[model samples]
Each structure stands twice: as C-alpha cells, then as structure tokens.
Target: MGSAREALLDAAYEAIVAGDWTGARMADLAARAGVSRQTLYNEFGNRDQLVAALVLREAERFRALTGQAAREAPGDVGDATAAAVTAALTAALDNPLIKATLTDDTSGLLPYLTTRSAAIMDVFREDSIAIFTERWPEPAEHPEVRAEVGWISETAFRLVISHLIVATEPVETTSRHIAEVVRRLMRDLTTT
Candidate 1:
C-alpha cells in the first residue's frame, strides 16, 4: 500500500516537473504509476489531495534541510537562522515545485503556499519554535518568553515566505537582513 502511494506521488511529481500537472489526468498518473484509477483515487481521493500530499512532502524536506543548516552553522541563534534561511532560499531557486508555482500563475497551486498554507505553516512554526526555544530558553518568572518566541518564529517564517513569493534582493543579502532583524529582536528581549 505504501509503495503504491509513493509511486503515485512520484508520478505526480514527474508530471509537475514536466510542466503538465495542470493538464495531467488521473488516469495518466495512475498509468505512469502502474496503478489503477481506483487505486489512485483510493490513495489520494482527488487531485487537490494529491497536491497537498506533494506540498507536505516538500515542506518536510525543507524542514529537514533548514534544520540541518541551522544546527551546523556557527555563532548564535540569529546566525543559525540566517544559514537556514539561506539554505531554504538557495533550495527554492532550483526546486521544481516552487518554480512551477511561481512561473505558472494560472496553475492554481499558489493557494497551497499562500491563503491555504496553514498546514504547511504549522509545521514550520512548530519547528521554528523548537529551534528558538532551545537556543533561548524561557527564564524563571518570564512566562511571556514563549509568546515572544512564537512572534519571532512567525515573523521569520513570514519573511521567508514573502521572499519566496516576491524576491527583490539576492538570497544571501535577504537572508543576512532577516538574521540581523532577528538578532536585534533577540538582543532587545535579552536586555529588557
């Protein structure tokens, strides 16, 4: 069952990479995966479900890559965040799903990253909170620290999303700017 599901996802990814996701029929996807149409439907329910699965998979991949980059970077949490953001932006530059979504405004896939991004953003938010909490633990008598951490996470994640949607500067430059902002915020929190 898992193999069939993976095959279906693989087939869908291939279609997207080939620039045919908008035109690819369920039957064609099932044929590519060597599965029946019923099997595909049973696995994913519909095209939107399949797309959600694909986007979630990509989000997990992003999380892993960014987590590793953060862990391996030198200096403080801000430095780690910069490395993670840089890794994500660099990956986005060549990521087929991102490319397809950005280049084809009519594909109807933009919602998965924008208005309908709760599921994806939830994953990123949880991960960011974990990373930040570990780096800056809550102090005794400071219950508001958690809220501050959440705000930082949301702000940083939104910045990355905005860049992905509307890139104005180079990846490294934007990444560094984000890091500096985060660093200032953290410094203020520490001093206050």
Candidate 2:
C-alpha cells in the first residue's frame, strides 16, 4: 500500500468526485483508505487541511505531466511551450476537480481552486521560473534578465490558465496561438 497520507488523499479525491466536498466525513474517508479516523486526522488535521493536501497533490501531478509533455516536444522553446500548454488545457477539461472549477459551484470548493489560489499560484510561479531559466540560461547571468524572464514565464502560464477558465476556442487552436505568441516574445527577448 502507498503511504497513509497518499491513501487518505486518494480516497478523499474519490469521495469528492463521487459525492460532494462536504459530504465526505473523516470516518468515511478513513474507512475508504483502510485507516482509522485518527490516522486521517494525523495525516491531515481536518477537512480544510485534507482539501489543501488534495489540491496540492493534484497540482504536482499535473505539473509532472506537463513537464513530460514539454520534454517530449522538440527542444525549441515555442514547440515545447505550445505542446505543454495544449496537454495541460486538454487534461484540465477532463479533470474532475478542474471541470468542477469551471462548472458553477457544485462541489463547494470551486472558489478554493479558482479565486483563492495562493498555494496554486506559488507552485506555478516556481515552475514557470524554472522552465524559463532552464530554456534560456543567459537570463540567469543578470538580475534584470532573470526578473524579466520570470515575469514572462509567470504571465504566460497565467494567460494559458485564463484561457482555460474562459475557454472560447479549441485547445489545439488556442495553445498553438499562445505558442506563437511565446515564440515571438522569446525571439524578441533574444534579439534585444
């Protein structure tokens, strides 16, 4: 079996998906994970803590998937960025939690995933900064360049997420277009 912490979170996700956020009780969750209520509590204190862990775990899993997509694309920045974004947006459309976020407020936790996204933002910020610096290491040499790259990376990630939130077109088209935008931006940066 996996760690009790992961088992609890996995059960929690299943419960939330099968039912509602508020419906999953500590005892029920423990039963699903084959752990005691105290074990669940010890792993995650309370419902709020459990939810936070769930979201964080989901985010990290998404990030890993996204990184894999990016790596599989051609080494070029634009190609990788576009490919990663397309995969992420496509996956988000099918993701239960992310889909719940887009649909009204059924789960009672959409706001936590969307508007109240401090922890999520921090994850994206760090991931974006790392992606940028890795692709264009010259930025690492200068504080100003590093800041600018950081801004570009974070802004790009936000724009892609915003597109997901306000999805108007197909993932293929939007991600492709954004990739071009990124290419242009990075090209300009290299030229300057």
Candidate 3:
C-alpha cells in the first residue's frame, strides 16, 4: 500500500514537472500513475491536497539541499550564510517542479505561491532555519542568534523570489545583491 502510494506520488510529481498540471485531471494523473482514481483520492484526498503535498515535498528537498550547502560553505559565518542562500535560492528557482508551479498559468499554482498560508510559511521557515542552524550551529542554542538568522533568511528568500517574479534584472545580479546584504548583516550582527 505504501509502495503504491509512493508510486502514485512519483508519477504525479513527474506529471507536474512535465507541465501536465496545467490541464491535468485526476483521471489523467491516475492513468499516468497506473492507479485508479479512487486510489489517488485514498492517498491524496483531492486535487488541492495533492498540490499541497507536492509543494511540501519540494520544500523538504530544498531544505535538505540547503542544509548540506550550509554545512559545506566556506569562509566566516557571513560568507557561509550567503553561500548557503545562493545555493538554496538557485536550487529552488531551478527546480523543475517549482518552475512549473510558478510559471504554468493553467496549474493554478501561483495562488499558493502568492497567498499567505501559515502552514506553508511554517514549512519554509522551519526548513530555512534547519539549514541556517547547521551553518551556525552555535546560534541554534542562542535565541537571539536564532531570531536574527531567521529574519535574515526570510528577508533574503523574499528578495530572491521577488527578483525572480518581478525584477527585470537577471537572477545572478539580484542574487549578488542579496548576498552582499546578507554579508553586511552578518558582519554587523557578529561584530556587535
């Protein structure tokens, strides 16, 4: 049963990446998964639930990658944090799933991205903080440091997303600006 569920999810994810989500129906998803529509509902409840699951799954993957990058980043805490941000933001934007979600007008995924959802925001923050704590492990034990890092991470991520969706400038340039801000923030925080 679990295997079947996983298979369904894998197929659904592939369909999403392939741009099928734009006009994808439950029947299409089930057929692609080699499962019954009933099975899909049993596993994922409904289309909205399925979409939410996909978003959360991608978020987790991004978090893991960011955590690894944070651990491996070079230089001081500031440089390391900036590197992690670059890695995580680049990965998120480059991800096929996210690209589809953000760009596929037919998928209705933009609403999820644009709307304020506490559940989604919690996932984002938790995942971001996980990577951040790994980079600044000591900060994890300090409330003030944790709060500061959280603020920085959220701000940096928002800037990256804004650039991706709204800015005319290239991502690399926007990324550099974000990194510089993070570097400055880290320097100030660490110095004082």
Better of 1 and 3 by TM-score: 1
lDDT of 2 by residue, 1-192 (tens): 359988999888887777555666799999998999999888888988888888888878778888788777776667778888988898898898777556736566666656766676676666666766676666677766676765677667777878988988999888888878777776676667
* CA RMSD of all predictions: 1.8, 2.5, 3.2
| Better model by TM-score: candidate 2 vs candidate 3 | 2
* Model 3, span 1-192: residue lDDT tens: 787677777777888789877678888888888889999999899988887777777666766676566668775555555565667667766678778777778877766655643445566676566665665566666677667877877776666556655656655566567778876765566556
lDDT of 2: 0.77
Per-residue lDDT over 85-165 for candidate 1, one digit per residue giving the tens place of the 0 to 100 score:
999999999998899888876678888878888888877887787776666564223667667776787788889989999
For candidate 1, the clash count comes to 0
* Candidates, ranked, TM-score: 1, 2, 3
lDDT of all the models against the reference? 0.85, 0.77, 0.70
Instruction: List where candidate 1 sits over 4 angstroms from the true fold.
Output: 138-141, 190-192
Q: Which candidate leads the pack in TM-score?
A: 1
Residue 85 miss distance in model 1 (angstroms): 0.3
The worst-scoring run of ten residues by lDDT in candidate 2 lies at 104-113
Model 3: which residue pairs collide?
none
Instruction: Enumerate clash totals for all models, in the order shown.
Output: 0, 0, 0
Query: What lDDT is reached at residue 75 by model 1?
Result: 82
